[model samples]
Target: MDQQGNDGWILVETLGDAPTVIAEGTRQRQCRPLGNVYRGRTLALVAGTIASVQASRQPARVLLGETVNGIGLVVARPVLGPGGDVLAVQVFTAPADRSPPAPHRAAGWEWNLSASAGPRRTRWTQEFRKLYGVSDTRPPHAYFGLADLYRRVPRISDIAVLMERVDNARPGESLSGELIARRDDGTLRLVRFVRRAVDTPEGVTLRGVDHDITDRTDAGELAVRIMDSDVAATVHSVAGVHAALVDSYHGYAIKWITAPLPGLSAEVEGGQVSLLHGDDLGAVRPHEPARLPGVARVSMADGSWAPHAVRAFPVPGYGSTPVVMVTFSAARPEQHSQHVGRGRCAVPDCQLA
Candidate 1:
């Protein structure tokens, strides 16, 4: 996935490798370095994902950083040998929404305003009942008043406005709006509604439908922030790794920072994976922040290790990824000289457990 799926799926390949993490890339495109095994610039994200697949040997899905009013994600499936060992990984990416959203039938409702009597009556479809997790025990022809309707969609704070809309609506007129609905289980959903007015034997009635748009709305909001130039783009586009962390002693919440931000901020279903470093991570704690200011072996643009000084600090953020921040810097001459000939243990390109 190019730009870690920020640019959508590009080239796909299959290869073999050891448990040891190594990076090599000789070219650049779309604001990122391209490596045969991994193009995800965020070390924490790439390192975490690869290490996860290598351990579980199962396919994993992860967010591909941020996008403009859209979402990016990649599904990495492990290629296994006959003996059941992971040989390589194949990743499929979605940089933009390429598929139509799944459909959800809008729940239907009917309001009869002709009743000059005590209260107007409204009839609702089974779809509406089920949408709010309401158990319908009444006959199909039953009628419910405005009070009952308000109780069902408690999250619609503007209940009075809704009733007024129906009351003032004229025959042959139509209206549309968005509302927040809450189910019996305490789950909240975003619903888009449409209403049309027509005359009937009973009286002028308003026909309405409520369709669920929660998933689409949520994804769109996330995409906008990610693609926003001032928000997540800086982390992804800047030099060195910019990672998000939950707290000290935890794994990377998402830290590609290579292109500049954590690409795997939205982790897999089970839990988040921490960066592979040990005590160094502890040093990043907010309460007693400290910088080792030592040299670490980073994965170079040409797929090699280069000495760099590590600088980290905490900052506020949003989404599934945690708060706290970390940035990497080039090592000073003395610090670089001190770690000139260290072994694999000294490498800090994010090694996962």
Candidate 2:
């Protein structure tokens, strides 16, 4: 029989009916045999066989699968001899049942607020957008930062004061207040916020929940303006007196009044009165009285009198210092602005001695 198709094997016929197998290399040891074929099989049957057949003359490749001890195995194309003949087959086996593990699952929401050295607007979380009644279709960058939120509120001073209080609060302490903000739709909303300071890698961060408080905040502000206008009118009614409203220690309102005097005198007095006091009346009272050179003690509306030790100086053409001049303390909370100097009517043309 011709064994020309199996080039890798050297066949030696001994005096026996069956062919003897000899020094087959490692390639044959790894591969299992395909089923036995009869000589009368058609050429088409041999061509369609899956046993990794290859032909040296045609440079064609084929893949084959076999079962070793009932386990399915796969192999690559076999080597072929010079003339369209198969030589030795090479195969590789892998487990087809095993697969890789699935990826890890993520935990709860991943939202964070950061502080930068300068002011800026940043992205908002999905929760924030929902709370503010914002559209999810809008980009996150459209959301405003805390600074922008503060600007939306009417009184900036009130926000500053609130921020100071927030800084001093103890752990777990939070403050709730109403603020106004403009939504992307050009509508305004007064949002009530419960805020607490949280120290984070990006500096102090304020995390809070916001609820719409537009109606309440608007009503409150209107009531405040009405009250202020009423007080101002009452202050103006007092004859020969000028007054200004000031914030009390408890953040309430108080009117500071000037001494009553005649028309020209009052006008002169108003000009000299300082808008803000240098002293903190809440802390300490003025040590010495401030009076003009010749002015005497004047009684207040409450039937009490404080002597004026430092008084305003009379100008050449203008009248003498008004009877009373309302002034604020120039001193800070730590230091007081006290009555320093007295005013005098030293003009040679003045009538009063």
Candidate 3:
């Protein structure tokens, strides 16, 4: 019941009773038997049984084999009958090496500006406009698609940078600085812009205010010096009073009281008596005897009078909080004269003759 073909061979069925081999190929010995077989059977009987089983049972082809070099491989698929019943099987043997399918290409470009709340139908283009002050009359699709802000207005670059800085800033943090830029109207301006970022569901939105601070800067400096010198002098004029000036919350205020300077004033008494008290004192203390509000009633400088001076503007941004008493003393006549020229003391009596 034995026969020889390329790598090996086999007899069919009982050899004496089974049909002859119909399909034969090279490397038959490498083909492994997959189904059950009777014990002590000849190779020819084994082949015949396998053929009958495959034909009658109609099992789908399940190739289990290896290359002549012994590299393993398996290939399986359903066998179909005339009515798609899968009457029998057909199998092929090959090496395991096989090429894979081609790689996939991208479908198309997509812009994901989807909103999570409010209207679901809102387009990203429209949202971009509302977020950045862009007008709706302009085309939406074309605007974002072409980055129109960057293209149509060159100054938008500065805006973008400022907004980015704001977005990164923390709460209560602000950016105050001068930026020179050409406006949409094509005119250039030195603008002081302050930006603050707010976190919102839509994203980080920057709220900014632009101001022309050129004139304000100059005026503010002058006002500050005038206020400091005048307040310091008023505190100095009171005899026996010691005075000192210090910056408080970026503005100025005065603290003074009457005190006895017996020997000090006498040393220069006849030298030249500069009337330290008069209309200038009246201006600060409009009352016959000036006294400061909210100061201690006790006259630390003099038993005859309490410390007093005019009320001052609250330190900018500091509200009504009173500054700490840095100390008090007499102001030099030259200093008082300088303040008078600065327009701090307009009262005729406070004016030095």
Instruction: Please state every model's RMSD to the true fold in angstroms.
Output: 28.1, 34.6, 36.9
For 1-353, candidate 1 gives per-residue lDDT tens digits of 23432323221112212232111111112212234335444434555666677789897777655752334655555544323444344344445355322234335567776745324556666666777776646666566544345444432123434544655677877655666555666466666655567666767766654556565456455333323222332532443333332233443333232232222222210013233244455445545434333433433334334444554444332222223444444646344334332222211342211
Per-structure clash totals for the candidates: 17, 24, 15
Give candidate 3's whole-model lDDT.
0.29
Q: Relative to the unseen true structure, what is the Cα RMSD of model 3?
A: 36.9
**lDDT (Cα) of model 1:** 0.44
Task: Score every model by TM-score.
Answer: 0.33, 0.26, 0.19
> How do the residues 86-198 of candidate 3 rate in per-residue lDDT, one tens digit apiece?
21223322345642222111011112112242111112233233323344364443312212222212232243344345324554344445444333343333444333343
State each model's CA lDDT, in order: 0.44, 0.31, 0.29
Give candidate 3 misplaced runs (Cα > 4 Å): 1-164, 213-353
> What is candidate 2's CA lDDT for residue 264?
23
Per-residue error (Å), model 1, residue 63: 36
Decide which is better by TM-score, 1 or 2. 1
TM-score of 3: 0.19
Per residue, candidate 2 scores C-alpha lDDT tens digits across 172-194 of 44455554544545355555444
Q: Rank the candidates by lDDT, best first.
A: 1, 2, 3
